[model samples]
Target: MTNHKLLIVGTVAALAILVAGGAYLSGRSEADRFAQCRTGNVAGGMEAFGTDFTLTRQDGARVTAAEVFTRPSLLYFGYTFCPDVCPMDTARNAEAQALLAGQGSEVQLVFVTVDPRRDTPEVLTTFGEQFSEDIVGLTGSDEEIAAVNKGWRNYYKANDAEDDQYYLVDHMTNTFLVMAGGATAEFFPRDTPAEDMARKVGCFLDAAS
Candidate 1:
């Protein structure tokens, strides 16, 4: 072939390469947009709340953190005997779950007891049933509970009980919304309204889906 013919062929090949490269990049950009794999970015890094945990479920079943967080979930840290704050907060969470269920949303609620000594699996099972059958009440050894709490950056302390009849637990009053696969999480105050909680959880579900 003549030199001119070879030059024309080379130009066509280069153009094809550029077009293919552009298409690949465009496709990758779209994938990244929808992935949303890590949204919990902060001053340090994209790390979010507790990634995984293991504890005894209300029914005395040993469940891993991975199992519980398979879908979008709401986690509330409190004990069964919490007289005022815990009861009220858990009740509110149950109401919010009801609201979401009405809209056909499938978000799970998890109640983790910071006071593990008195809140055994049996006690947690009974306490969780009072709110909703869907709630998973969790209790673990003191070390296990503490490790989980540290992962969540939550704090709690046991107050004195009179005659060991009733006790108070001072704990963080924040509930956490963990996205599917436990990749990200957001915090909401305990007093967050049911409507708002439902709306926010719906948004997270929509995004995850």
Candidate 2:
């Protein structure tokens, strides 16, 4: 074939491939389309990861996961008394939330204390304010907290110590990205940077939308 004919044939083939790919994507379900946004895998898959639970908010009002997670939310499990790790992790989440906000994406920050004994509504309200005023701080009875923890598969234990007031609690430091309907979209490791978390969350949000 002539060079002009060859060029024309190549263009037609490219267009055909593009059309086929677009059709394939359009035929996929919403979950399949958003699957590309996933960075890591959960043990039993995302559907089995998160569950709804009732807990008290910073304002001392009882609320459920569905109510607090009315939008894309960063859910964390930690304590106000945590000397180092919790503070750093929550600060990173706040930073990520701010980044998303600047890019026109609104996400809620949820802090569920593992040390409910010391993290009352008043204490949580003060702790949450140190990061973001809009942060949702949740605490509840031991049973309620345990149920929520079990639903999320969170591991936390209080240390055996002589001084109960100053004792530290051992807990997981992962931050979960939960969608509006209580579906856990993803999770970030303790070392994940704010920018990286924001970018991943943004990808998920875009895919979901």
Each model's TM-score, in the order given?
Answer: 0.78, 0.85
Which residues of candidate 2, in runs, are more than 4 Å off? 1-28
lDDT of 1 by residue, 24-119 (tens): 998877445433533344453324468578899988899998888877778999988777888888888888899999999977788999899899
Model 2 vs. true fold: TM: 0.85
- Residue 88 displacement in candidate 1 (angstroms): 0.9
lDDT of 1 at 53: 80
Model 1: how far residue 104 lies from native, Å: 1.2
Q: Which candidate gets the maximum lDDT versus the true structure? A: 2
What do the candidate models score in CA lDDT, each in turn?
0.80, 0.90
lDDT of 2 by residue, 98-138 (tens): 99999999999999999999999999998999999669999
